[model samples]
Target: MGHERVHLLKKIQEVEFAAVELQLFLDTHPQDQRALMEFNHYSRELMMLKQQFEMQYGPLLNFGFSPSQYPWRWIEGPWPWERQY
Candidate 1:
């Protein structure tokens, strides 16, 4: 993987963390519109980043979330634990 991909993955992790935190907060404060908005914003950002990453590399998911140019690209890369990033 390249530097840019690592950066994007890190960003996705950060955004996902924030979204999960907001979800927990919303669980206690279901009436809080502000927290809901923030969660939605982060979710959208995360989706876009995931899409970009998949386009440049391969599917981040095990299923067919993102299509690949090569049919077998999904199994071509190093396993997740083997990746340096």
Candidate 2:
């Protein structure tokens, strides 16, 4: 795999984990303003990272999560998430 792709995937994974963790924390402690702020930050960052990945390497999702491009994009082989480390 290319270095750029690997780097981006790793970063996306980290941000995704942070966002989900913060979300769970907020669910249990809704009064924690700092956690809420952090969650929001990570959520936005994750969205941007997904967008970047999709724009560069095709859809980062499947089953209608990503918009279809000309010639039906996701039908191609080796999706972004399918790359081996």
Candidate 3:
């Protein structure tokens, strides 16, 4: 909901897109080391983003929801579809 969270969410979205694009490319060029490397990088970033989001915001999925030091305010925030992005 703040500037930092917004920035993190944007980065996570970008990484997600990049990973998906790389996946499509790898489908045809599975032997391409460059594509593999990029995909791994993006995947790592995406994982980190997800973890950070959960730490600061809340679970990215319903199953991941957990109680934090304070009440999980993120549950009250937008669902993925409802988020402005």
Top candidate on TM-score is: 2
> Candidate 1 lDDT, tens digit per residue, 1-85?
6677677778878998999999999999999999999999999998998888778777777766667766767886754324475
Misplaced by over 4 Å in model 1 are 80-82
Summarize candidate 2's per-residue lDDT along 30-79 as a digit string, tens digits. 99999999999999999999999887777878888988678677877566
Scanning candidate 3 in windows of ten residues, the lowest lDDT window is 63-72
Q: Residue 25, candidate 2: how far off, in angstroms?
A: 0.5
Model 1, C-alpha of 29: deviation from truth (Å) = 0.9
Candidate 2: misplaced stretches above 4 Å? none
For candidate 3, write residues 1-85 as lDDT tens digits. Answer: 5667778878888899999999999999999999999999999988888888878666667654544446655556665445563
Q: List the residue pairs that clash in candidate 3.
A: none
TM-score of 1: 0.84
Tell me which residue pairs clash in candidate 1: none
Model 3 ranges off by over 4 Å: 64-74, 80-85
- When sorted by lDDT, best at the front, the candidate numbers are 2, 1, 3
Measured over all alpha carbons after superposition, the RMSD of each candidate to the real structure, in angstroms, is 1.9, 1.4, 3.0
